[model samples]
Target: MSVLDFDNLTKRYGRTTALRELTLSIPEGSVYGLLGPNGSGKTTTLGLALGVLQPSGGTVRWFGAPATAATRRRVGALLETPNFYPYLSARQNLQIAADVKQTDARSLEAALETVGLAQRQREPVSGFSLGMKQRLAIGAALLGRPEVLVLDEPTNGLDPQGIADVRALVQRLAAEGRTVIMASHLLDEIEKVCTHVAVLHQGQLRSAGPVAASLATADRVVLGLAPGTAADVLRAALSSLPFVQDVRPETDGRVSCALAIGHSPASLNQALFAQGLALAHLEMRHRRLEDQFLELIKN
Candidate 1:
């Protein structure tokens, strides 16, 4: 089931339209990534869905119903920098958050343990690293035991270790059956952790689907024939195979071609062997997510 849905959602500020007619659904139990560069309306879309900003037109729904207090209670979000009392201990800070959230203190221990801050719960926030602090912020958001979590650039300003920590934490949360919607400009991070992604550009939806399906490209298979085999023979054989596409000559005297869906390098090898050709070299070149991301936004 969809945990959230945006129907023709639009947002504007005077003459500037921050987001335009964006219709998308976030599935339950998915680690959904909102992918875009800065000012691509990623934050604006989150704001509209959270009701922090009113939509200029369209609708935001939660669990197949309009967002209300009860529905909002099911979602926890961290949209800005994590703010904490510098002198307060980690546990104390969470207590304060619990008070604000009006959630019972019974969930405090679980939140601390979930964020891996249980051991340092008594340490001052001032002494914790930026990564620890971000985890605490997420712990605070978890105070109400919300079913959905929305994080905007959860690892925006962390060290490598910090980024890894947050990424793992997000994965754990999703594993526990909570829906997570995170916005990020880092293609690698999204590609690594997100099960699904929605790419946005200039306030418009570019693409949205499961990561494998959305970013899938025909991987090119490079082939080299025996010393006695002419390149034309190889090209001719490839051309005859209807599944082979975009046959091209590599600079290193190798031929490369893409195969249709459901076709594999093994299948290609067998097909060539059936036609009295043998390969001396065979390799599959996979496409990078960065290349795909750039292609999506370049236009």
Candidate 2:
């Protein structure tokens, strides 16, 4: 079942349309990556999902119901840059979060420990570094023991170890059956962590589905070959085959080409063999989510 759904959502600002008829379903217990470049309305979508910003049109649902005060308790969010009272200690800041979320006040200690901030619990927020501050902000979100987590750039501005720590925590949250919605420009991270993905561009959803499913295709295949006299002969033979789009030499003595629909790897191999060239390697490269995002923005 979907934990969150946006049904024909639209948001307008004066003459600008921030979002347009956006629709998506986030499955329960999935790590969903909400991805797009800057000014692509990713942040706006997150705001609307959490009920921090009301939509001008359509509605957002949490567990098949509209976002409400009761729903807020089940959801935890880290939107934009986290802000805390500089004078307050990390422990004190989380205390405020605990008071608001109505969770156990002592859960603050558990939250601090989870984010590796146990020893710095008494340190003032102003004294914390950027990555430390980010961790503390996440600690605040985890204080409520939420069923869903909405985070924007959770690993941004962090060192390598800090990034790894945050990544591990997010993965652990999903393992514990929490639905996590993460927005980031880090495509590699999304590729690694997200089970499902939603690509947004110009405030609209370009694509939304399982990461693996979306990447599955038979559009084209790139083949690497041994550097030899058969390169031209191989190209000539494959070029005559039906559904071959284009063939070009690669920097690594390989031939890159595209295959049309109904063209199988076996057929491609057969064509190459007919020309006296043996296949060194055969790999199909599908359109990446990053490539799809760029295509949407360009259009």
Candidate 3:
């Protein structure tokens, strides 16, 4: 069942519209990615969904019904950098947040462990790295053990190690059976961590669905043959297959091709093997999120 639904949701600021007729559903137990470039309505969509901002038109629904304050409580979100006292320890800060949110004080211990900060519970917030700070913010969100987490750029301003840390943590959270809806401009991070993705552009949804299926729906595939084989030999084989379309050559002596809408890497491999050819290297590449985002807005 869908845990969240946006029914023709629209949000506008006077003459400028931030969202346009967004109709999307987020099922339970999904790690959903809300993606777009800056100023592409990603933040606005999250705000509307969580009731932090009112929609200009249409309804926001949670758990198959219209959203309410009680429904909002079932979701935790971090839209921006969390404010923590520089001198206060992690535990101390969360304690204050718990009281402010009126969540159970007993959640303090579980929240700390959920974000993997229990070991450093006594450390001052000032000493933590940017990634640690982000994790602490997520810990604060996790205080109520909400059924869903709405995180806007959870890995912003972090080093590579920090990015990896947060990715693993998100996966862990999903494995625990909670839904996560993350809004991020970092396409690579979203590709790595999210199971489902929705791409937005100019206040409109360009695409939405399972990440792999959406990417594979229409993608570029690169096939490299070993030194003993000529490029023409493989090209001829691929060209004969119905699933391969727009077969072309690459500068690196690889064959670049597009798969038919319903085809996949496995289908290509199976078809090639039937013709007695073993693939030395096969890589599938899709238009980058940046390129796709531009195309969405441009068209």
Among all candidates shown, the one with the greatest TM-score = 1
> Sort by lDDT, best first: what order?
1, 3, 2
**CA RMSD, predictions in order:** 2.5, 3.3, 4.1
Off by over 4 Å in 1: 84-93, 116-130, 227-230
What tens digits encode model 1's per-residue C-alpha lDDT throughout 12-119? Answer: 999999999999999999999999999999999998888889999999999999997778778888875778999999999999988866789989999999878899
lDDT for model 2, on a 0 to 1 scale?
0.84
Instruction: Point out where model 2 deviates above 4 Å.
Output: 218-220, 224-277, 280-289
| Superposition error at 182 for model 1 (Å) | 1.4
The clash tally of candidate 3 reads 0
Error of 1 at 13 (Å): 2.4
- The model with the greatest lDDT is 1
Number of clashing pairs, model 1? 0
TM-scores of all models? 0.88, 0.85, 0.79
* TM-score (C-alpha) between model 2 and the true structure: 0.85
Which ten-residue region of model 2 has the weakest summed lDDT? 213-222
Q: Over the stretch 145-201, how does candidate 2's per-residue lDDT look in tens digits?
A: 899999999997789998888889899999999999999877888888899988888
TM-score rank order: 1, 2, 3
Better of 2 and 3 by TM-score: 2
